[model samples]
Target: MTSPQSVYRAVAREVNRASISAPATRSKTIVKNFRTIIESGGQSNTEHFDHDLANAVTFMKSQRMYKILLERYNPLHDMSAEEKVKATARRVGLDVPLRENSDEGQ
Candidate 1:
């Protein structure tokens, strides 16, 4: 049985090898999250954390790692703005129309 740490390492190795977009993006995000978690409880300043993350993201954006990951990710595939709005509405149950079939507006 593999531990999560081992799994993460393996994933990271694959992420490093993958020039595809998605996995690289995911790896970067995971690394950022780890950084945040690491510094959250310490004397770490918010600005420092933000600045570091921003810098790291920028650097990551330029690497072969980033390009490979981005290709896998292919930023073009995310939900459209319209779809996102509709999804949010559906989640809150706003999707069901309140009007009755016999309403006067009909």
Candidate 2:
């Protein structure tokens, strides 16, 4: 009993609703996976739809993956590589020469 235009409109509305809810669902899943990984000592019994969340976390943290994720997922993510080295050195009480002169004439 609906016109073609009305069917198209309905489909569009449903698509918009799904799009709105999709991100929230994905965010919830990510948080849940992180929680499971933490609670289970690096084990996850649940099957992840796209990727294995626990394994992905392990790979990212391990040398298998690059260090970019640390900046991607933290407040200090904005710190540059040089800044991170400096911060690490300071934290461990190691003296590091300034970047400008540390590698100069060597």
Candidate 3:
């Protein structure tokens, strides 16, 4: 035979306890979400850095190849006018016919 006032006090105590813990629970969840976002941002930055590095490496290699070709072949000095035209077209992936290929028509 608990008094009605005693029952009301018991329910009020439990409600107060829940209200006190709610913010702590919400704070923990927010902290966890923030940490996850920071971690994912770091990973995305790493991936972007890796992609940039690979592109830089590819560009460096292409520059090195162009330098080597300039040194080894000296196209302006070594190639004739027609050869230069054909070589330029071939480098640009054009299918314009050269003298040899055009000669097939004669």
The TM-scores, one per candidate, come to 0.28, 0.25, 0.29
lDDT at residue 71 of model 2 (Cα atoms): 44
Model 1 residue 46 CA deviation (Å) reads 0.7
**Model 1 C-alpha lDDT per residue in residues 7-83, reported as the tens digit of each score:** 33544554355445665355477555554554462345656655554454446445756666775866444678876
Ten-residue region with minimum lDDT total, candidate 1: 1-10
Candidate 2: misplaced stretches above 4 Å? 1-75, 99-106
> Candidates sorted by lDDT, descending order?
1, 3, 2
lDDT of 3 at 5: 39
Q: List clashing residue pairs in candidate 3.
A: none
Worst lDDT run of 10 residues, candidate 3, spans 2-11
lDDT of 3 at 27: 41
Error of 2 at 100 (Å): 5.4
Candidate 1's displacement at residue 78, Å, is 31
Cα lDDT of model 3 by residue, 1-106, tens digit: 3333343344343333434356545445533543454345445566664455445445555666676688687856667897788778888999665347766788
- For model 2 the local lDDT of residue 95 reads 72
Candidate 2 lDDT over 5-46, as tens digits, reads 343344343333334355545445544544454446323333
Query: What stretches of model 1 exceed 4 Å from their correct place?
Result: 1-43, 65-106
